[model samples]
Target: MNNMIAPSILSADFANLERDLKRVSEAEFIHVDVMDGSFVPNITIGAPVAKAIRKHIKGIMDVHLMIQNPDMFINDFKDAGTDYLTVHIEACTHLHRTIQRIKEKGMKAGVSLNPATPVCLLEPIIDDIDLILIMSVNPGFGGQKFIPYSLEKIKQVKKMIGTREILIQVDGGVTLDNAKEIIDAGATVIVAGSAIFNAPDVEQRIQDFKSLML
Candidate 1:
């Protein structure tokens, strides 16, 4: 499978978001992190910011909603230029219904799991979604240490998804140093924020990560 690099905007310079977005134009997807203080801790951007930056994204607009009652905003995000909408299983009371609603809005749907969520929990809905975002660090913040055991968790998710074409995405604390191992464990999409935007040369840092894709 072809691997992809999705640069997260959570670590972007909010004051210079449009400019920061231009820096990672080389990435395969622009990872939009929509956070609500109730679900995690920090409150990030909403659909409006997503719409503002949509024009600058060269590739897919991968919107990950880390909030409660995600179904209520599915239509709003779709209208905001979200090409891919990922909702947290922990947040969705009726995941299948939420997935249907997202697809109904004509956007590709994905599901995410917190670091503590088990891979088996995905068995029922594995085939229904386009991607599975595996969190390597605790949700709610960036610049944190990656959990060592997530590698094995990725492997387990791979086994559970055997032969399915669904994409395996790894987010949180994904840096160049451990990216290879994460890919080897079956992550097709790598979501990095600090590892890319935090670099001295953001574009070059994105390229360095892309260099390892093959």
Candidate 2:
């Protein structure tokens, strides 16, 4: 399978969002981190801002909701033009129902696991989700170092997935140095924040990441 890149907008220049979005236009998806301040220590943008961002990006809007009770705002996000909606497995009380709701809204349902969370926790719901996002760093912030153990976790999840069509995505601290190893470990999608937005040349940085898949 072809590896994909999703550039997180958390590290983007919010004041010049249109230009920043254009910079990463080559990416397969645009990762929108939605933090509610309760689940995560920091609060990022919400559905309104996500709707605004959808208007600027050319690729799919992949929204990762790091919130408490994501069910409450599922419809709101769906209305915001989210192509893929990912809820934290730790936050969802009824994960299956939430995943069902996402699918019902015609959006790809994805489940995200924190760095500390084990891949075995997803065994039961592995076949249900369209995507599995394995966090290489903790969920609260960006620019953190990638946890080395996440590569092992990706390998475990890939073995558990077997012949399933579900996509395995690795998020946080994805840079050129680690991108190849992450993909080699079985991640189909890579989510990068600082590595892309913090770079001097955003388009070239994306191209560099794409080169790893080659």
lDDT digits (tens) for residues 108-170 of candidate 2: 999999998988889888878999999989889999999999999999999999999988999
Query: Top lDDT: which candidate number?
Result: 2
Distance from true position, residue 200, model 1, in Å? Answer: 1.0
What does candidate 1 score on TM? Answer: 0.98
Off by over 4 Å in 1: none
The 10-residue segment of model 1 with minimum total lDDT is 119-128
Point out where model 2 deviates above 4 Å.
none
Q: How far out, in Å, is residue 119 in model 2?
A: 1.2
Report the number of backbone clashes for model 1: 0
Tens digit of per-residue lDDT, candidate 1, span 154-206 = 99989988898988999988899999989988999999999998899999998
Which clashing pairs does model 1 show? none
